[model samples]
Target chain A: MPKAPRAVVLLGAQRFDPTLVEAVKDLGIKGRIAAITAGWQEREEEDDDLEEHLATLSVTTENLRLHARAEEVFRADPEFHKAHRERQALLRHRQDFYRIRLEHALDAAQVIRQRQAPEAILEDEAHASIQAIRDLDHMHLSRCAIDRGEFEDRYRPLKRPALAKHRSEIAEIIAGSEGVAIAGGHVASLLNRLDLFGIAPMLGGKAIFAWCAGAMAISERVVLFHDSPPQGVGAAEVLDAGLGLAPGVVVLPQPEFRLRLDDKERVQLMARRFAPAVCLAMPERSRARWKSGRVESQQGGVFELREDGTHALSVARHSVPPMKGHVAS
Target chain B: MTGLTPLAITTLMMPGTDARKVDEFLAGKQFPLTEGPNVTFVWRGDAEGVNLRHWIYGLETATALSRLPHTDLWFLTLDIPEGSRIEYKFEVLRNGKGEWIEDPRNPNRARDPFGANSVLQAVGYEAPDWSTKDDLARPGTIDQLVFDSPSLEGRRNVQMYLPARFRRSRQYPLVVVHDGKDYLNYASMKEVLDNLIHRLEIPDVIVAFTDSPDRLREYANDEAHARFLTEELVPDLAARFPLYDRPQARCLMGASFGAVASFSTACRYPGFWGRLLLQSGSFAFTDIGKRNRRGPLFDRVVEFMNRYRNEPVAVSERIFVSCGVYESLIYENRSMVPLLDATGMQVRFVEARDGHNWENWRDRLREGLSWVFPGPLMFVYE
Candidate 1:
């Protein structure tokens, strides 16, 4: 079996304001870094901004073009493409059913918590409410896993010739590179491409840097969340089981824009519902590192949300570990 | 003096004030003074009677201002609602003659086809920060496409907004806008598109802005106009540009009469444009008779609206309607929402404290555009 990654660095939105350079410099990595921007879909090869940013620190960048590869695979194997579409439809149906249950459960929890009662009773009810949500989340996640597991069992897509060839090519690229950087895009697309290529195992022992959907794709479970959507009620839902590379953490990217942190009830509910796994809010320019199966370091408004609803993220810069390699010329 | 606004101090309490005090008060201050929901419009010239001339429906069009006893300052304080944007002009009566002019003291003005009016943004009313030009946002290029349309039997000019990072290899959602030049000039549309696209609030899109020489005649549910858009313009643009060949990737947007053009076009070609962003649409309809209060200009519009009301269909999948409460068309717009929603299409109607002008349409662009064609930001980012 492949060993665990050296460090799983999760950053915030890296489109307009990127902190990949700082993350790279801190890691003392000055060599070739493989990039997976499959989430960008048709615009997969548009990594000029990212390349330029990393180039400032003399870090050579290589876009793996997994999205393009997936397209090629689909074109080459129409049967695989049809199966993938069918699987996607199955997952979507499961999600719709799960949403119906999750919404009612979440509403019941909120109602119970807000009811007029004694302090002790209210506290107990709040706990129960959180537990109910957590239970539903676990149930939903398990059902999704079964759906995905069944599909994987039936298809055995990794054994397919096209995917296998690309996986080998990708593994070889990662082997040559020092680290892998994954940029943000549509989360579901990113997760799908990553799973299709089976690039998780190949990331072993390499410094893995990801942000936005990229960060979410690496976690044990991917949660789709937005506090205020334009049309519908914003509910956090379990998308699917992620790569499981970074465990015991629910990453919320662009929290400042996506979440209403001022609403204490909402903050408390979100934090408590995802207990055991720390609910980390990664705003722009924020960074959090997962090492040894836990968050070892964080900085730049990287917040650990608690049930109290306080939003005082420590702005003080943390000390960086000593450099192990010389600066690139 | 401790807790009152500057205008309140000068207008209410001061019994023995001079021109120096009034000049001092007016200096270095932005007008009109907006404190909470109350807006005080101040005029600093000598006149027999100064009236606030506005077009806000349901309110007295011409409201007289009270002059200070010792100074030439005339002021009128009206309790405006939060998030309401009103526009008005000052009708100064000098030497027994009334001369209408834009607010000399206020720099914020909104221009329209008719003329210009001074803008008053109450508390909680702010033009989206993205409406302004940002140096960081890479600007898009606009290319003109002049073509002869057999449907309309005339030559038409359309300007295209290609996003800063537009690539021919990638397919883009297209939004065809009516009264294109007016939006570009008055609404700062290019700046808005640049900023929204740069910030990822909306995807990189190909916007086709179209104009008509005779909008009143052409845009009022004209079948030829509809044909020109659905047949002539859209197909031509699709062939020229890399556009997604699906209804969900297409949109038609306009304001007022322009909105009538978009609505009628979509009705003509149902399921062709998946989204419709209609702002203050001139959807004039009567419950009984064919005549409308908006007069002869809205005859064709009212005729079409009446017919659609009788037999409404789900022309598009989603629609975004925004109308200013201050405009005369608010009632028509408000009534149309339920009818549109009942057609089984997803409908969103937004009402602003504004009037029927370009700026009112401009202010609601973020909400209307983002909902219709959301970018990567609106997607699930975990």
Candidate 2:
């Protein structure tokens, strides 16, 4: 059999969503697939357990470490130190606030618990009342992060060793794989760095697959929607060129939950402004296969564009059902 | 010890009202209160009569009033447009005090960072140029024509966009889009193509927007709509335009259910369409609850794939796929991406931060068209 394509899996910033890994395996073109967990500096014992689980799939898991020299540079940077201090302060404040809130909430729950009397005529109702209080307390504690404005900064920074290891492992994976699949937050940044280091070129002869952030990183440009005054990353903004694995603009995938017209228009405007070599929008589960220049869809999906100043939709046969009710006559 | 204080009085007046007397009284005076609309008279709290302290007035009350009193008030009566609802506010000295306050007369107010308060009239939008329907007529090249699909009679309308460079002189690629009206009219697709072609982004191409006929049934069934595009519409468009006779030059694109049609048609007739652009396609056969009640659409898709897995693509074609970052169907799209890539076909997958919509689709059009036809004549803005 054709050597199963060697595969490299990158996981660092975001926790791996199990469903994403299963999807990769389902593709069936596999050799050795490895997961490099290099985003976090200090790995807890629980992380080792997760690594073990990943190993069961014939995928090796390793933690990449940064060199001492890089660590020295990071420590010497005043701005980095300042930012780190601010983050620490913010974290402490949040922790204190949450602790107080949790205490208060638990106290309220205890009060409700004490009100439940065994002799009460409505025993089930009284138990439900106590449960409801506990649920409310839990919700309050969960929402404490929002109140403290530290939700975004909650993720602790990874140590230098971990960061360097991740970069090296990703490079190694790309070099060995017949194909590579990457999924996670920070995938775009990682891809850009890899491209800069010429790691992406190693996979030039192989097929590459990226989902969500991973997909965005491989494109010519990655548009970040998380920032205010929306900004474009990768080649367009000169932040860093993407892996250049795919030519064109990378659209940050938009969900289909809010059925608003203006929201759709905003997305279109962003795409036009960025004007990547290609723009991709995944409103649903759609796949397009490219072969020798011919791109074909294997599922139900739609692609729209302006032609001669008019818009057109290319519909795949199997995916046209949900849209049956909305087309104009 | 001797203490002395002078009492000053000031009066307020509305715009277009006589306020010359009040202005003269407050000239060079300390603690002076300026005259404004909506205030009839004022009293001074200051001991010095030389210093006008406050002014109040019910300057004017008229339904046809042009301007109200407040900071930044400019009133020049002219023939304003009819049926216009103007917003304005009046500022007046409160109870003989120097404090000028906003009008209590106006009912409309706007919320802002400062606080909720009245605002000036908003400029109305000029009417769009709806004067001519010249676009209704078919161009000379495509011979602007309309088709009533017997398969979708009265159920759908299909619009064709022939490149401005379209000539009876040569054959051109044909691309079929599912949401005809959205592509042709709503998205200004014709203009996009014109610009793209002018910029030489893609080669000369003909676009036939075959609207979904009862989008629910046609897109869901896939068979009906696919048949309509391949069997009925393709022949019709070819007869009308100088379309390339071979399927190698043919392409399909759409989003959601429209995406389904694009892939299904290509799979069914692998030789017919050489290019495809799938944006946020609904490829998860299990999730489409009601539509797949009879049977799973995935079976058909898999069957098509199995049948055509080894078939040599007539002409090297390209496929572009993309989805939103937060879209629930992202996993499904990811799953499908590898499947398509495994077919030994060129696949470009894209992910954006938005859900399924025309905006992203319009952008995808720009990129996908360029990929499908990487030559001069594809749509691009100047």
Candidate 3:
């Protein structure tokens, strides 16, 4: 089997500043890293953030318009557009019910927090509650997989004549670049485009650096979360199956905003919910390194969610290594 | 203190009352002296500055709290009704910009998108005896679950309060509460439910606290939020819980945008929620006469309120609206009452002597919830 990508996740905000610059130097890369800002959506072409960050370095940045290219594919094929829209709407419809059930589980966990139950019983309740949410996530993911599987079984998007030119172009660009940098934006939009042009296969056995939604999109699963939003209520949700470049780690970008750090119950629940995977909070100036498909180091206040309801940047990265593939629930 | 009846002067105690909601402000404060209909509110606070104003919502403007001599404290005694509960904050003007703050001593509070407010419960506003913890009273079980949403591209929590007396053979009413966490920590809803059910004040209900992933964007008259409630939440809840089958048995509730969530859901999915318990709803509208005119912050709220006004539809069988006299949304809520009446729905509109906060909603529960899901003993007491 191909070795998992040697990926390093830096915080989304101020990701490329001195931190990313230092990371680039640490990796000792001399060639260009084909940077993918597909996550930026409409501003996919804008690399000012990347350009400015690496202005002094010999390492070059190449912008890949995966988002634009995906849009072109949709525009080129009417049948594919109809299928994609229908797929999205169906997932949304199904996801509503999934969310309802998920809320029920979270409420149960919240209730468990209030009771003066024994530690053992509390653990049991917490474990069961977390498992329940995980199970719901699994089911929703399965349905999504099926939906996409059905679509791909017929369309065979990569092999289609309409997508041949774009597919070959991306393959050649990624092959030429020594590394790839993915930026953040609308995660769903980014993931869809990356999936359409088949970046994951091309990214195999490559050096990858991602931040924010970019970091989240590279992992085995994409979990969207927020604690206090300007307009909406806060809930940590599993958005979709990711590219699986960084395995066994749920990268939580901007944990300061997304996490209810003071709320012990929520902290404990989130940690236990995405257990074994190490719900790593990628705050600003933080980094998590994966070498040969395993976590090698953590720095700059990078922390992992623990079962005991504590967050820490465990000194020993070898203690919880990243597996090559998905850690089955 | 002024122009009050003998009963209104009966100095109700200010300590030991439940905070009801703690996330908003300090709790366990409020002394009320009441006659038959009106009551006097006495609140104590410590001030660090001269311009100590009570930035109470629902009312027209802030009122200055008379500072006591030789003390860091200030007192405000205002007369209101027998069952009015309001939310208020102390605005200390320090270095120009007003600092809105919570009552240091008062335990009861309510929270909105803006911030926290101390709650004031008037006399005769009994928050059901069962709402209080009694070792003898059998409590319900609340469980948390995750709900995935593709439309909003999110997954949120759903808090379900199943009564201690749940049985597969038995059916119960469902009350969907928006702003789930606020209702839980702030409103003390779970305790309220246990107490209400134990007392049989309301029918045994399976309440689902439907949390908002985005309250401002999702809850403020947004159809997707409504769909999440009706299409996703309720249906999924009905499938699992042995809930009362009729739409009339279900209730949707919230305070502020949460109230807007309930109102908009009821409007969008008519009959989904049999009742709406709106407390100081931010129902901004300019078309409900000149008094309803509002600002740009209220533009989206105005659009929604106008849509419902132009097409007055039967959202719920009965609606209970409670807005504090000292709340920011009083005019808008006042405009809503007449419009609700015009919709041919049985409406009970209450003007709380307090402000826009959760205590106002918590105190009104006895009236609103009991009316919506009146138990068998409702007539016996009457």
Best by DockQ: 1
lDDT of each: 0.84, 0.45, 0.70
Residue A118 of model 2, lDDT score: 65
| Residues B1-382 of candidate 3: C-alpha lDDT, one tens digit per residue | 3444444222222343222322122233343333444433333433455332444653345666554443333444565566665555667755566777776656765665467766556665655464457676689999997778665568878888888878875568888888877777766777877776666567678888877656787877787778877888778788898876666678898888888878988888887677888888988776454334455555677788887878887878778888878777888789888889887676878776665555556656767777677542211100
Candidate 1 lDDT, B233-253, residue by residue in tens: 989998999997778789999
Question: What is the number of residue pairs that collide in model 3?
Answer: 52
The CAPRI category of model 1 is acceptable
Where model 2 places Cα greater than 4 Å from the true spot, the runs are: A1-329, B1-144, B148-156, B286-316, B377-382
lDDT of 3 by residue, A150-246 (tens): 8789888888776778889888888888788877776777778787887776776567888887888788888877665321245677777887767
DockQ, prediction 2: 0.01
Winner by lDDT between candidate 3 and candidate 1? 1
How would you encode candidate 2's per-residue C-alpha lDDT over A91-125 as one tens digit per residue? 43453344344435444544654675666645565
- Give the least accurate 10-residue stretch of model 2 chain A, judged by summed lDDT: A320-329
Give model 1 RMSD, 1 decimal. Answer: 6.7
Each model's TM-score, in the order given?
Answer: 0.80, 0.33, 0.53
| Candidate 1 ranges with C-alpha deviation above 4 Å | A1-165, A176-189, A204-209, A228-240, A268-278, A283-329, B1-25, B44-48, B67-72, B94-97, B379-382
